[model samples]
Target chain A: MLRSPRAIPYLLLLPSIVVIAAVVLVPVLVSLWSSFTPYNLTRPATLFTFVGWRNYQRLFANADFWWAFGRTLVFVTVALNLELVFGLALALLVNRVTTGRKTIRTIMMFPMMFSPILVGFQFKYVFNDSVGILNNALFSLGLITRPIPWLVNGALANFSILAAEIWMSTSIFAILLLSGLLALPQDPIEAAKVDGCNPVQVFRHITLPFLMPFIYIAMTIRSLDVARAYDMVRIMTNGGPAGRTELLWTLIARVGYQNSQMGMANAMGYVSILTSIAFTFYFYRKLSLSRRYMGGAE
Target chain B: MAEVHLSKVVKRYGALEIVHGIDLDIAHNEFVVLVGPSGCGKSTTLRMIAGLEEISGGTISIGDRVVNSLPPRARNISMVFQNYALYPHMTVRENLGFGLKIARQSPAVIEQRVNEAADILGLSPLMDRLPANLSGGQRQRVAMGRAIVRNPDVFLFDEPLSNLDAKLRGQMRVEIKKLHQRVKTTVVYVTHDQVEAMTLADRIVIMRDGHIEQVGTPIDLFERPVNTFVAGFIGSPPMNQLEAMIGSRPAGPVAVLADGTELPLPPEFAGRVTADQAVIVGFRPENLYPAGHGIPAAGQTLDMDRTVSLSEPLGTETMLFLDFGGREVQAKMLNPRLVAPGERMPFKLDLGHLHVFDRASGKSLRA
Candidate 1:
């Protein structure tokens, strides 16, 4: 009663603002400033001694850093694209299901319910070089006399991690796109059918156009999540086989924790954030374009 | 020649059959309307002809081709839906040409037909706008244009004007009539509104519980409905029907209403009922008016007195609601005179325009 109506809303919102500042804003600003310094975790007093641009300079000249960066770009692109293709197919297939649709949707989300680390461990055992199920099955089936090393080879190791990442995340895309499929007005599809379009034509012309905005939303969210692909790869390979399958997080963790160079790791973190920014920007643009195609305001 | 024909058509869903076996023949360029109440399977019959619903046990032919097993596209029919299902993602030009484009016509042909349809519907100004940008009537015209672009053997409309407001609906009705005249396609339209059925159809098919009770022209249905159902379903503010018994009179036969009031029956229907036979006597509201003030009463006349319960006066006529033998009946009085409540006003009955139905079967006794 003491406060004005306008001021009361601001007063009620103050707690959330304070909480978010403490949890998110402080850490982000501190890390960004630290990325410009020679701060080390072991010697916490070095947090204030700023050696501007030196850490970034050393990172740019480091070949292994660039390799990890390039490898992560490739990994995220291949994994996210495959997830999208499979997720769209799964959504289309599940949309056609009339009976037990709820049960099917719940089952589809089973892989996403597991922790990423658990999925990594599960796939790790399945891909063990000599004793895992994959090589054992290959040996018993007489397809190969020698044991196929799944995790030891560079390409196979990347493929295994990509598979694990896709398995853990594709269902989210399917669920989102399926909900979009459900919300679509059925009249246009019926019109298309009456307008001489076959099933394939209907899917391409009407159904896919309606599903584009949903697809882009899923892509933007998954790009950010897949860029933070640390837990699964850490449990799976730990950047092993002489760093042959090294990604951005593995190198950054090694430099920041194992070598006690937090400032340099934070520098690498800033650069890695650029790739996620690029993907989010690309996907958001595409989402808005599709929305405009549906007659939404630009 | 029949453009679309359904012989012994039926529609069943699992254990329940909605449409019984029925027959309909829509001749070339004939506009036929199926009018009924809800759940009367009028839309089902239309869908069966469009190949949108699977027919259970009969043949539907489009111009001599038995399209029983064919899809809607193969059957070559177009439908205008109730909601005007224009594609929200496409402009009007694209929406109109989509059917032809899918049928693999050349660019010039699709363009020419789309332009022609746009010209017919006067949709050139809105051709570049998406469906969402257009108003409801514009969207409806675009829908009609989409159907016109197809130019198929038959056009099926499933309550296409049910969504419009009354004024827009009236306007669309006139436009649709003109479109039918210009396009000259066989049309099988379905609506529950008797007014729309009467205004638009060359022949009206009145359905009740999935069965066609009668099929006739507007004048035919209005003047000679086959039964009580057809009589009630065909007119607006429907015909007033009173329970009565056939009685012998010294002059002629009479319908003795329940309250001991005797109204003379026409001599043409003298033998349609016997003495003491229970019957339903029906007459249009216009037939009962203030004595000597109606448009000649339109039939053989009998004088009576009834008290007005409520009066609704329009500019041209007053609709007088009165009790006839303890039954609520509406009567029209021309020249707009105020008749107060509880006033026993002299009225006339057009006995020549009366209907007598056997109460047991609800069937008309007239030959």
Candidate 2:
């Protein structure tokens, strides 16, 4: 005989799907539709009038958009790589410890618990041009003779934001890599020693390769996280001084939310989404290759 | 190859001592097995010798030098873990060659050595495969291969066969024996399986509660146990013990069971007795045979009225579980015709092969 019908399962799933569609899917579709039109939030009637490729054309010629695009790429690339380096160092240090390890691990996760907005505000005040803690401390110590223009200089402003991003996100990498380190088999390390391997060699050949999958996983996750790096950048510089630190998000926010040019902003948003997909795909490919290199699959 | 010695070696984790001071001298190229129940210090002792653990007191010497301060690399010992801790991310070839590569060996030398190990282990065809791709037995072989490629002075195994299935354990046990015979390295193996200890050890060290109770040839401990613990832990199906009191003192010293039946103690043991001292009488399951075979030729004998409780039949032998007085005892018979459960069969206790222990100290009454 056929089984009895089960409406309860479908009923249970319906509410969640409705909520997700309302909160997530609707916004995405509405934005996609708005990208093809000359829709401005101030003029609601323009939602139905399609403007072909004019918004995309404006973006293609816009110097501000191109610069912001380049700056965003540099920011993500430098921040992610630096975070990986610092994270790997921290994980190795923690892994070498013999006592009070649990306490150390919990403490390392403190930076990750703070909101990005809070981190930005904290660092912003610390690096303020005239009255900042860093300048004041340097001046009092007779270290720097002048008050350095930290947030005003174009290059220094961008570098400061990059440094803040690295500091805020490095712990994620360390925690993930530390778990990989802990799960490693003790046998291979012992065998390496019996085989007459020194510590550095063991780390390079055994430890590093074993940790590859974890590193790539961290990279993939952080690429997505950094692609959406908005709050910190907004609080610190706001694409500042002369648009020197103007990343894609700040540019898009100004266009879409502040200026209410919803259509042009949606076009920029779609273009920026491609950048995230590209980074994710790159790291995902690296992860699979590492696994294959380890002979997990033929 | 070298001899290993643990002279009063001890291990303590804070206030709890896992291995008391143990003194053992393993001869060159000797195959020594440490066997005991769980919570015994057998594995801890092996780990100490391997330099994986620090000696809390005393000294451990590989060959003739004290290795207390040496790191595992300097100790020149390889360990085969119970789980066969092969690196899951590396191919067999990579895993085997990793140590050599780390030492910066010449590429050609590393290749030749890895190939030789692969050939010896019969892992050539699977050299490019990862650990996940191999079977349990293959993984175990690779673990052995990893150890062998180093050609260290001592081979330490920590219950290596414990992770295998029964059939696989038996097969690997023979393979290990053959490997030892071929390579002739000094081996310190630890296991709780008496059968493994019996079949492989040149000398067996039996331990209990962080102290070695006895160390001897397998037959030495089996035939002349130093205490009740060694007597009970050595033999298969275990030795049977019963509480008894001294009686029938005029003609000979005899033991009276709970049922008031009488059995004579061995003539050699009669001198060590008093009438009121409590004692535990011990005998192996195989030492008690069917009564028609008559009593053993030497020493005293006892005939018991036992209620047969269970019968376990094997191709070459049968085990009879029978209750004597108030306690159960196991008796083994050679290829017996047929015996059913609950049968009242007479059995002879070979008293010359029996053991007696002081109940208070669990120490043997006589050698």
Write one digit per residue (lDDT tens) for candidate 2, span B41-106.
898888888777788999999998899988777887888888776776788998787766765789
Model 1 in CAPRI terms: which quality?
A: medium
Choose the strongest candidate by lDDT: 1
Q: What shift in Å separates residue B73 of candidate 2 from its native position after superposition?
A: 1.1
By DockQ thresholds, what CAPRI class is model 2? Answer: acceptable
Chain A TM-scores, all candidates? 0.91, 0.91
List, residue by residue over A1-298, the lDDT tens digit for candidate 2.
1233676677778899999999999999988889989889999888899888889999989999999998888788888899999999999999999998899999999989999999999889988978789899999999999998888899888878887888888989999999999987676676566566678867876788889999999999998888778899899999898898898989999999899999999999999998899989998998997776454221
Interface RMSD (C-alpha) of each candidate?
3.9, 4.3
Which one is best on DockQ? 1
TM-score of 2: 0.90
lDDT of 1 by residue, A75-193 (tens): 88888889989998999899999999999999999998899889999999999977689888888899988877778888888889998898889999999999999988777787888
Q: What is the C-alpha lDDT profile of model 1 across B109-128, one tens digit per residue? A: 99999999999999999889
